[model samples]
Target: MSSNPESSSRVDPSIVPLMRSLALELVIYGPIVTIYFFLVLHRTNNWLTNIFNASSTEYAIVAVLLIGGQGVMLEMFTSWLLRRIGLRH
Candidate 1:
């Protein structure tokens, strides 16, 4: 409804940094997470299979714990990485 077309097309300056940070995080996390899962799956395939075969309930609990622990560890690692790279304080 506004008369000015330029104003509608303009991006907020404050959002640029946030977008950059998000892009950087995605770039950093993508390969690390992929390699992490690759290694985990490769190394733990047999062990996890055994657990699943032994008891579904136990497997479910262990799977949840592993996922939660992975999330915590990855977050910590990513935060530390960002600090080291001077992207975050």
Candidate 2:
């Protein structure tokens, strides 16, 4: 169960900032999701809510989109951050 730091080429120092940014994204996502649900509920006015609730697939779709959004946001943010910091490869 011993590990060697030099054996791992997958991680780079530049990735540290990106990892930090992703952590920040997770912190932000919670509030964003909460607000998004409230807005959806407001716009749907119970009809769409009931429709989504009646079908697990619909709810699952929402969950997928939410997670996808997080992933894309992390990737794009990291790429943009790298470019901004002149760390792009």
Candidate 3:
């Protein structure tokens, strides 16, 4: 058999909803997380320490990594949920 729809790993490329979610998450959490890490935990920055906030050349690269990993987790979760509902091969 060719196979059922849910047997594949292919994700639709449109991804508009996921892109929107990614942007909103970056806007909401990126600065806050970076600031906390740099100023609070690392204690290497001051209020005016925009330098440690995040280099422009690397705009929240770590944050993007975390968010991207979270996206993969979410996809796995959805796949598991769908399988539980008999929607998968």
Candidate 4:
């Protein structure tokens, strides 16, 4: 019922960035999943025992460090992938 057609047909600019982030997340999580299977799942008792042996503070610190390391690795991987794909110089 409105004469302004462009207003009704306006596109969202944030969707592209959101999608790119999702794709990057998928790529980033691949290594974490692989590591989980190879290290944690394969040696469930050993890993669980190690966790149980550590103090709460020590466990929290290690968990944070591992997550931070994963993020750093993800960034490196994303950069490498982008360069290989010729998207980044």
**Each model's TM-score, in the order given?**
0.67, 0.38, 0.33, 0.46
Model 1 lDDT tens row, 1-89: 55888787975667666677777888988998889778876789999999999999999999999999888998898888777666643
* lDDT tens per residue, model 3, 54-80: 475454665576579767976675556
Show where candidate 1 strays beyond 4 Å: 1-13
Model 2 agreement with the true structure over 1-89: per-residue lDDT tens digits: 98987778765557777676666656665686678668864675666577577998987887688679877976786566556655435
After aligning candidate 1 to the native by TM-score, how far in Å is the CA of 30 from where it should be? 1.1
For model 4, where is the 10-residue window of minimal lDDT? 80-89
Candidate 4 lDDT:
0.69
- lDDT for each candidate structure: 0.82, 0.68, 0.58, 0.69
lDDT of 2 at 6: 78
TM-score of 1: 0.67
What are the per-model numbers of colliding residue pairs? 0, 0, 0, 0
